[model samples]
Target: MSTPKKPTEAKAKPGEGVSRRGFIRDVGLGTGAVGVALSPTAALCAPPALAGPGPVPVTLTVNGKQHKLELEPRVTLLDALRNYLDYTGAKRVCDRGTCGACTVLLDGKAVYACNILAIEAQGKNIQTVEGLALSPEPDPLIRAFVNNDGLQCGFCTPGFVMAAKAFLAENPNPTLDQIKRAFGGNLCRCGSYNGIRRAILEAAKSAQGGGKNA
Candidate 1:
């Protein structure tokens, strides 16, 4: 009926062509099949599970008393003393060996309890502030601290006392300059450095006058 009828191209019916949802579903199924095929091999090549060290027996001599405890080797001396032994004199502040708030005496030397491991402290002479007042009369250094008002807030007082005790033992008659230099490791948030220094000096004088150090 016309100059020559053009051949008509056929249109695809509904649901006849690849669809977005269908493509996605097919790809997901293929991936899942691959995963299922490889799962056995993957499991066979996997590494074995590892676990951390368990708690072991630890014995500590604190304040001239021996204590037996089961603790992890990684536990810190400060935690063992404060949490396990109930010796909370060493404040848990700046736990990274700074601030000196967790200072204690190990073998008659000042050390940060947070820095030492509980298991490593075995068989060592451990002295905390609580041990300083075992006698009826408080230690002279403690008396001096109270008299000079060397502490405020009192959080850092125990550390300061322990550090000062070690320092005085090393240099019984330390001058003001010596004290200032030695106490550089310890810090006071309340800014009680002046009173602390005076207390150290007074304690030294008292020791010279036949007063016991501890």
Candidate 2:
């Protein structure tokens, strides 16, 4: 009969094998855990490093609520709203002052979203189209759009709505000529300006009667 090896010797190899595996696992997972823990904080505290000189922290009051965000110093209000805060109602088009597609409300005034840098809007009450639908949404303006068929592609509708709200707030009862002059800057390729104008008038009338007039 062949002689059997010692159990103590066998036990030593098994112990070594388990220790080796534990060492490998710890080494492999150590950096990954650290990376995960730090990434979310970096996102919350720092903006993406663009090819710019520096970044700025901005506080925006949107829809009667305050939000704190870190953004690149050069980022526009449109991009910051859509990309960072996930408010994408303001459409980005032309990106210059030519097209009014990215219109938003700043302190109850209409302003081009793409032109104003996000950091410049600090301490301002910035209202986006997203808020338009929040308080009993499909308000007078949205109802008018539906009734008048004011949207063709619907891309420029948000800008028009923002402009109209500002206009009506200024002149609750506006004539056709006044309405045309008020919304002159907004452009629509679908030729829906006529419908949009009528819709605004309807909404203004509705707003005059406490948002209940059909």
Clash pairs of candidate 1?
none
Mind sharing the TM-score for model 2? 0.72
Query: For model 1, what is the C-alpha lDDT against the true structure?
Result: 0.79
Candidate 1 lDDT by residue in tens digits, 145-190: 9999999888899999999999999998778787788988789999
For candidate 1, the C-alpha RMSD (Å) to the true structure equals: 24.1
**What number of backbone clashes does candidate 2 have, counting pairs of residues 3 or more apart or in separate chains?**
0
After superposition, which runs of candidate 1 have C-alpha atoms over 4 Å from their true positions?
A: 1-52, 210-214
Q: Candidate 2 on 1-214: residue-level lDDT in tens?
A: 1122222212212122246676666546644644754677755766665322233456777777776765555567886777666677888877787678888999999999889987788889998888888886577999998899888999999999998888888888888778878877799999998899889989988778743333
Question: Residue 50's C-alpha lDDT in candidate 2?
Answer: 35
What's the C-alpha lDDT at position 21 in model 2? 71
What is the lDDT of every predicted structure here? Answer: 0.79, 0.74
Cα lDDT for residue 159, candidate 1: 97
